[model samples]
Target: MIRAYAAHEPGGKLEPFEYEPGSLGDEEVDIKVEYCGICHSDLSMLKNDWGMTQYPFVPGHEVVGVVEAVGSKVKNLQIGQKVGLGWYSRSCMTCEFCMSGNHNLCQDAEGTIVGRYGGFAEKVRAHQGWVIPLPEGVNPVTAGPLFCGGITVFNPIVQFNIKPTDQVGVIGIGGLGHMALGFLRAWGCEITAFSTSPDKEAEAKALGATHFVNSRDPEALKALTNSFDVILSTVNADLDWPTYIKLLRPQGRLHLVGVIPNPLSVPIFPMILGQKSVSASPLGSPTTIAQMLNFAGRHHLEPIVEFFPLEQVNEALERLQSNKARYRIILKMDH
Candidate 1:
């Protein structure tokens, strides 16, 4: 039996719950969750924002844990290895996308919290493929966000082949955006952080932004027209789409990693004229995740995190819901 905290209804407080998981699959591994990160997606699911959450939901996908059990066929992991699991729990290994190493694009990919109990528990189970081993020099406590937020931003840098010499812009210096600044800086790009909050300029620079732009200021945005090679937007809020498009250089791209609810109202004429592109992507494949972890380890990059005991999950949720967390929030399990 796995003991966990669960919500019986939307916006309900998480309470103690327990259930016996059936026998593990031949390819599954059971993780003894040590730390789990609370993402905005968790809150959205808690409120049924996307309308797919099930009751008694245990919301945690950014998981850093020890492998407590492994199925017989699991060859790459041992019972005591440290690992992390992200938004995805598994993907159909035989899909064309999966076969081609784009498992995150697999149509049959399984979300950790979509319809199953997640890592906000004593133990969580997932197929071996999604259980990423933590590399040396990476701090597990602050590593949780890398699996989701970090990878979300990093995947685009790889997909678009962002050049080290390119000028990059990151919009919204929050969870995902903050990390993007760091990754883009390490990738050798000249980074500009665009944020409505001018007060965050110093902190954004400290996080690897070479310049800061007040996104709320029209003149400030207009000054950078046709200057950026790539702009990565990490805010979920809709903004002046046409203005951002105009800021891109010819053949440049404006990429989104945030979950913006509304359909984008982009001006096609400017994009067609400049050959610029607008695109978005989910998290990366496991192989890409491994590469990200290694890069993070080498660079000593980690999220700015606040820790809360697992027992005080409600309070932590409130902190995130209130948008008061400095950055990421991690729940430390008292085993």
Candidate 2:
């Protein structure tokens, strides 16, 4: 076991300090983490917003690192291979969902946040099957957020089968929405940004939004009935489901991905009447995650990011909460 520095929530909040190295089981691969990114989910967990967090918690899921050691039985990875891990740490592989390639839906799909430790530490032991090979040209620090934020956006884009002829609306332009726009653009779809702020219009266009619609504009929203083929809702706040439903075309979908902290009112007319599909994914499956990474790499696509030192994790997270971070804020482990 090697000593690792991490920010842990001893009880009330996360504070940076040294954490004792823990033993690794033979089924795990010990990773020397180079970088980890602050995700909104981390904030949710640390604040007991999720009600599943354990004390002395280390909050991070978007991890990129090099394999330091692997069990003899590990056949797929080698020492020093660059790899990445995400929100999910482990899942019961014997479950029906795991066998069916829908591991995200597994009854025991545990997170890197909940069941085990996460990536804010200088080192982490990850399940071999959960580790993904990083594309050569992408730096590990840059690759970290792709594991969570990137996949969160990419899964819905591909799942919805969005095409060039389709109009796609991306709600909220903070972290996930920003990446979603890039994915949609690479897929050659016409994208519209539905944001509450007028100032975000320029930034939205820069991120590949062809059209910007102020969500506050009643007339503009009224004119969009049956306009979009799919809308990926990335906002964490309660959405205007009634207005958004009108923007969908018959057979179009309003795919919800973001998690709201409170109850939301859903308008039944959105899909019940038109036979439209309304769905959301927990995260991408392993196959889908691999495909999304390769697609991003091949397209030279990178999510916009700002770097924060490991000690400044709280500040970084605050930026994410205040919607100041352009897309993501990656934390580097100062080894």
Candidate 3:
């Protein structure tokens, strides 16, 4: 039996719940969850905003825990080993993408909280492959968000072979953008933050942004025409697509990690003339996640997190929903 907090209905409060998970599989491992980060996606699932959430939903994916048990076929992991799990809990290992080390792109990937329970609990289970071991210098208390939000921003850096010399701009500066600033700054890029909040400017610079642009300022944005090598949009809110497109240098990319609800109305002429591109990616593969963890550890990069007890999870969710989280929120499980 595992103890957890679950929502019984859409937009419902999470309440105490328990379940018996019978017969753990050979390739699987049972994780005794220590801390779980509350991502915006978790709140979205809780509210059924995506219309894919299941009731009795246990919403957590940014998980840090220990291996309490491993199946017969599981190797490279042992009891009491500390590890973390991200948005994806499983991927069919036989796919070409998986074989090529792109497990996150696997067609039959399973989300930790989509069809089953997740880490808003005392214990969770997942295939050994998706359970990443923490690097030596990383703090367990603050590492949870790296599994989801961290990777969402970090994967692009790996996939695109982003250069330290590149002039990069990050949008939103909330959960995802803040982390992106840290990573890009450590990566040696000339970092610029595009945010509407004047109050966040100082903090953005503190987080590694060398320059701050009030995204609402037309003059501020207009001055930067064809200036950036890459602009990573981390906000879910819609923006002036053509304006941002024009900000890119030739061959530049506007990559999106945010889950915007509406269709993007882009001005194709600017992209065509500049030979620019727009792209997006999902959460990263296990291999990429491991690399990201190592990079984070080496650079002493970690998410700025606000802590909440598991019992106060509903409040934590509310905080995230209200955009009141400092950067990221984590639920510390009780022993």
Candidate 4:
């Protein structure tokens, strides 16, 4: 049996647990997890915050590891290779969505958090299709967040083709927000950060945000009306739809990758009046994920992460829920 950290119920009452490490399937690879990032989704599931989670769940999706073994049917991967996995575990590749390279939206898509045990443990077994090899010289601990939060923002940015000199705004300065600012700056875009907290101005600017707007300030909001060429919301809180929507330039798209549980409230008049559109992404396709990883490697883009021992998974979750981590928090397996 492989050792894992598990929450038997809500609120992340996690403890060291064991489970059967059944033999790998024909197309599977068993990875010895090196580092795993703690995401808010993990906390949500642990607490049943979203109310759709299955119990006895081990919450982790941003997984980075080394291949420990591979099934006979596996190809394009080898033992000892560095590999990483994100939210998606499996999807029906034959479906229209999957066929169009949008596997992240496949109706039959199985998540790493739900159907399969995730990376908050010593080992993770994955289908070969969902695993991607890491480039040499990248630290697995820092690489872990790239699997989820990094990719969440990067995918939408790439999908919308936000280019150099393009006016972009990142709405939030949390984990995903910091990553978004870093990626936008690396891509040579002109970036503005939208936040309600004035205390984040210095930190946001340090992450390459060219401007900062206090979203709660009427004057600041007015100054930005119709200003952004592209804006992506990284905050998981509700937004003043008309306010943020009006900030988009004509034909500009607003992409959302965050989970704002409440229904979006936006006036049709503003969207129609501004000629704006709304879009979102689940995470990213494997192809795009690989490209993002390469880009992060080339640009030296990475999140500032706090490290914790594997046994400290519960502590890490508490910090993540409390917004205490500087940007990212990761648990290192003691392999």
Candidate 5:
């Protein structure tokens, strides 16, 4: 049996719960969860905002734990090995995408918290493939968010082959944007932070931004026209899309890691004339995740986080829902 905190209905408080996990599959590995990060997606699932959340929901995907057990066919990881799991738990290894090292794009991928229990528990199970070993020297206490939020922003850097010399702009310096500022700064790019909150200018620069632009200022934005090589939007809220599009240089890319609720209204003429492009991506693949972890470990790049005990799960959720989290929230499990 796995002991966990779960909500029985939409917008319900998480309470102590237990369930029988049945038999472990041949390729499955059971993780003894140590710490789990609370992501915005978890809150969305808790409220059934996406219309796909299962009841008796356990919402955590940024998992840092140890391998308690592995099935007969598992080979790469051993019991007692420290590891992490992110948004995905399983993907069909036989798919072309998986074979090509892009398993995150597999058509039949399983989310850690989608139809199954996740890391907000004493134990959680995932296929061996999705279990990533922590690179040597990586701090596990604050490493949880790197698996989800960290990777969400890092994947695009790899996908787009963003260069160190590139001029990059990051929009919305909250959970995702803050991390982007850190990574892009370490990647050797000159980063400009775009946020409506002028108060965050000091924090943004402290996180790696070389310049801060109040996104609400029209003059500030217009002055940077055709200046950026890449602009990463990390906020879900819709904004002045056409103006941002114009900020891109010729052949520049405007990439989105945030899930905007509405369709984008982009100016077609400018994009055609400037050869600018718009694109979006999900989390990185297992291989890319490993690379990201290694880079973070080398740079000591960890999310600015607040810690909460697993028993205080509801309070942590409330903090996140109220937009009071400094950057990320992690739930420490009592062993």
Candidate 6:
């Protein structure tokens, strides 16, 4: 029996739980989770916000661990290898998207926590293809978010073919936005940060933002009209969509990685007149994820994180719910 923390009901406290995972599948690997990052998606699943939560739910997807066991058919990974798993646990290998190396977009993809138990346990199982090897020089403790939040923001850069000379803007200087700033800077782009917190100006700059625009100030936002080559929105809150659209230069793009619950009402006139575009994407595929990890390793880029023991998961959840996490929170396995 593998020990884990699970909530039997939505909005209930997570407590001790155990489960017996039967025989592993041929393509599956058992990972001994060392550090699991608590993401907002975990909170959403706990509350059944997306209406897809299954009770006795173990809510963790951002995981860094060592491969403890591999099924007979598993290749390309070996026992004792350190790897990270993200929101996805499996994708149908025969799908068109999977064949094209866009496995993250597979329609039949299996979420790590959507229905099945997730990495909040002492050990988790996933298809070998969904488990990415961590590059040398990346810290496993802080690398967990890269699997989820990091890849969410990084995927668009590759998909859009964003240029190194491009001027990029990142909204919300929190978990995802902070990582976007670091990656955009390391990619050699000029970075601008759109934040409501004036106190975060310096911190955002330290995180690789070359400019900080207080989104709370209409004048500050108005002055940046048609300035960005790409603006990456990483905030879940509702934003002034038209204003953001106005800030895009001709042929510029506004990409969303954040999960904004409401339908965005954008001004079509501006997009049409300027030939601007709007797009969004989920986490990257295994290949793109590997590229992100390699880039992070080469640049020594990492997420700013707070640590909590796995047993204190409820407390960590509360912190995340209260919006008190500095950037990201990692649950360290105490067992």
**How high is each candidate's TM-score?**
0.99, 0.94, 0.99, 0.97, 0.99, 0.99
- After best superposition, candidate 2 residue 109: deviation in angstroms? 1.7
Model 1 clash pairs are none
What's the lDDT for residue 96 in model 2? 88
Error of 1 at 264 (Å): 0.5
Model 5: CA > 4 A from native: none
What's the C-alpha lDDT at position 225 in model 4?
A: 78
Per-model CA lDDT versus the true structure: 0.95, 0.82, 0.95, 0.86, 0.96, 0.95
Task: Give lDDT tens digits, candidate 1, residues 104-151.
Answer: 999999999999999899999999999999999899989999999999
Clashes of 4: 0
- Tell me the TM-score of model 3: 0.99
Candidate 1 ranges beyond 4 A from true positions: none
Against the true structure, what is every candidate's RMSD?
0.7, 1.9, 0.6, 1.3, 0.7, 0.7
- Return the clash pairs for model 2, or none: none
Off by over 4 Å in 4: none
Give a tens-digit lDDT track for model 2, residues 205-308.
98999999999899988988889889899988887787787788889888888997577566776578877777777788887888988888888778788998
Q: What TM-score should be assigned to candidate 5?
A: 0.99
* Tens-digit per-residue lDDT, 87-110, candidate 3: 999999999999999999999999
Tens digits of per-residue lDDT for model 5, 1-335? 89999999999999999999999999999999999999999998999989999989999999999999999999999999999999999999999999999999999999999999989999999999999999987899999999999999999999999999999999999999989998998899999999999999999999999999999999999999999999999998999999999999999999998989899989899999999999999998999999999999998899999999999999999999999999999999999
